[model samples]
Target: MENKQLLEIAEQAKENAYVPYSNFHVGAALITKSGKVYTGCNIECASYGGTNCAERTAIFKAVSEGDKDIEAIAIASDNSSKNEITAPCGICRQVIAEFALDIKIILGYSKGDIKEFKIKDLLPHSFTGNDLI
Candidate 1:
């Protein structure tokens, strides 16, 4: 799907975020190489560390659907006042790196700001499943 469409999906996903802890709602959308799109929102847990990020949730959902080869991802957050729109975290990056290194990542903000980059751009020289070989 087009980045614009993916951004729309991410925005919709954000509405489903269950973030009572930090109150930072985030959403993610992943498009598979075969043209299927999957979306997810951040789910926060009282345990803090048990929280799951929108990026990982979307990626996991895509993988579970047998979309092992991801093409692109978009992340959106309405909490732009406190933080700028950015890519996935180290853990999410590594998880994405496992399935896709050349995947495109679209970071979106509430104020109409947007950023785009390949997954490799966020995690340069990252250790992936290839590292196990």
Candidate 2:
């Protein structure tokens, strides 16, 4: 899928974010190598630690469906700013690295500004399943 299309899906997913505390809505879209797309929104919790990021939500959903070979992922936040780009957190980065070390990560804004980065670029020398082997 095109980056813009993937970003659009992520933006749509952002609307479903359950953020009653921080009010920061984030969305993510993961695209498998086979062209399957999984979209997720940030889900917050009262306990804070129970919160799930948008990226991980999408990745976990894909994994639950037995799709691990992710080709690309797009993330967008509904912060009402088009110039502000948000990257995945440390935990989300690690989770993404587990399945796709070289996956493309697309960070997008509401005004059409987008940036792409490889997973390795976000997490260099990451510890993956290879470390356990």
Candidate 3:
């Protein structure tokens, strides 16, 4: 599927975010190598530590379903400007690296205004599982 289509899904998914604390709603759509798509929204918690990011939510869903060959993921948020397109947080980035090293990350913006990047570009010289072993 096209990146724009995936982004559109993410845009719609953001409507389900449960962010009472930050009010920063975010959504993500992850597509696997087999073309299956999983969608997630940022789920905030009162304790904050229980909060889960949209990217990780989607990725975890895919992995749990035994679909770890991630092809790409698109993220969308309530950013009104192109300059503020949402990017994955640090924890989300590491989770993505654990599943896919060559995944494409799409930053969705006001329709048609999107940015794409390789996961490596987002987390340069990343510390992967290999570092631990």
Candidate 4:
């Protein structure tokens, strides 16, 4: 899908985020190579370590459905300030690298600013599945 449309999906998903802890709502949308899209929102748990980021949630949902060939992902957050924090977390980067290191990651802001990047761009020199053999 186009970046514009992907941003929209991410923004829509952001509305569903369940973040009672930090109040930082985040959303993610994953698009498989077969033209299927899956959306996810950040789910926070009482146990801080159990919290799941929106990016991984979306990718995992796609994987659970037997679709591992993810082509792209879109991420959106409610934060609108331009503070150079429009990026996924380290754990989320590892999760995306496991399936497809070349996947496109689109970052969206609540203020309509968007950025598109490849997984490798965000996490260069990252360890991948092939390295764990």
Best by lDDT: 2
lDDT string for model 4 (38-94, tens) is 999999999999999999999989999999999999887876344233578999998
- Structural similarity to truth (TM-score) of each candidate: 0.91, 0.95, 0.94, 0.92
lDDT of 3 by residue, 16-130 (tens): 9999999999999989989999999999999999999999999889888999999999999988235468889999998899876899999966465788998988998999989
Model 3 misplaced stretches (Cα beyond 4 Å): 80-83
Ranking by TM-score: 2, 3, 4, 1
Runs in model 2 deviating more than 4 A are none
Model 1: per-residue lDDT, tens digit, 1-133?
Answer: 6677788789889899999978878889998888889999999999989999999999889878777889989898875434477568888888888887898998875346667899888999989767788
Per-structure clash totals for the candidates: 0, 0, 0, 0
Ranking by lDDT: 2, 3, 4, 1
> What residue runs in model 4 are displaced by over 4 Å at the alpha carbon?
80-85
Instruction: Tell me the whole-model lDDT of each prediction, alpha carbons only.
Output: 0.84, 0.91, 0.89, 0.85
For residues 1-133, could you state the per-residue lDDT of candidate 2 as single tens digits?
8888898899999999999999999999989999999999999999999999999999999999999999999998965255567899999999999987889999867466788999999999999998999
**Residue 113, candidate 1: C-alpha displacement in angstroms:** 3.3
Return the lDDT, model 4, position 14.
Answer: 84
Model 1 lDDT-worst window of ten: 78-87
